[model samples]
Target: MNIFAAIADPVRRSLLEQLAREGPTRVVDLTRGRGISRPAVSRHLRVLGDAGLVRAIDHGRERHFELVTDALAEVSNWTATLTAKSASAPQPPVAGHHLDALGLEVRRTVRERGTQPGTRHTAASSTATGEIA
Candidate 1:
């Protein structure tokens, strides 16, 4: 299961939060007071385990599962990368009255010159109220 997809389920996310807050715990400890069934909790844990979101340790007859934060860190790192890239990206020219006026001038120039068919460039003319032709 995808890590993000696994975390999408509230129960699985709650399990992760519980593991984070309470530290490593056994299956019984995880499900003892919860309304969810033991088998359901086990299934959730399996999905988390597949996603590397949790790690399990077997001690005697009990299986203890703990949050493996490294997987979450990977997600964090991916978001950070996207954030950094966006921050460094160039901003587009802001559209305002100035741009609207410039667009009018361009349209008028195109109307005066007219457009040539089969040319690489084609221009559309619009009125001040923005009716297009």
Candidate 2:
């Protein structure tokens, strides 16, 4: 199952949140303060581990469960890309000067595209006056 489907259950989400806050913990530790039984908690942990959301590591006789941060980082980067695309779409200018500023910014960005391969460009850096469009 996908990460979203695996975490759709409230119990599973709680387990993840707990692991995020409390660090790696044993099954007994996870279910101690929770309202569910140990077996139910184990089942949820199994699903999370399978989905790569939570990782289990052997600690002595018990297994400690912890959040898999890399999975969350991938999700965050995907969301950020979608948010930036929607936010940057063209819209009607609020004033006459706004359209001119937007045009200049776009032109400057195009001009800077052939510079060094590793060079970084911000919205302000692309503008002649160092102001964001």
Highest-scoring model, lDDT: 1
lDDT of each: 0.86, 0.85
Tens-digit lDDT track of model 1 for 1-112: 7888989999999999999999999988899878989999999999999999999998898889999998998789889999999999987688588889988887777677
Distance from true location, Cα of 55 in model 2, Å? 1.5
How do all models score by TM-score? 0.61, 0.62
Error of 1 at 120 (Å): 38
Tell me the deviation in Å of residue 82 in model 1: 4.1
Model 2 regions more than 4 Å off = 94-133
**Candidate maximizing TM-score:** 2
TM-score between candidate 2 and the true structure: 0.62
- For model 2, give the 10-residue run with minimal summed lDDT: 114-123
Measured with C-alpha atoms, the lDDT of residue 13 in candidate 1 is 92
What is the C-alpha local distance difference test score of candidate 1?
0.86
Q: How would you encode candidate 2's per-residue C-alpha lDDT over 1-133 as one tens digit per residue? A: 6877887899898888899999999999999978889999999999998889998999788899999988777668878999999999897658779888988887777676744434666666668555565
In candidate 1, where is summed lDDT lowest over 10 consecutive residues?
A: 117-126
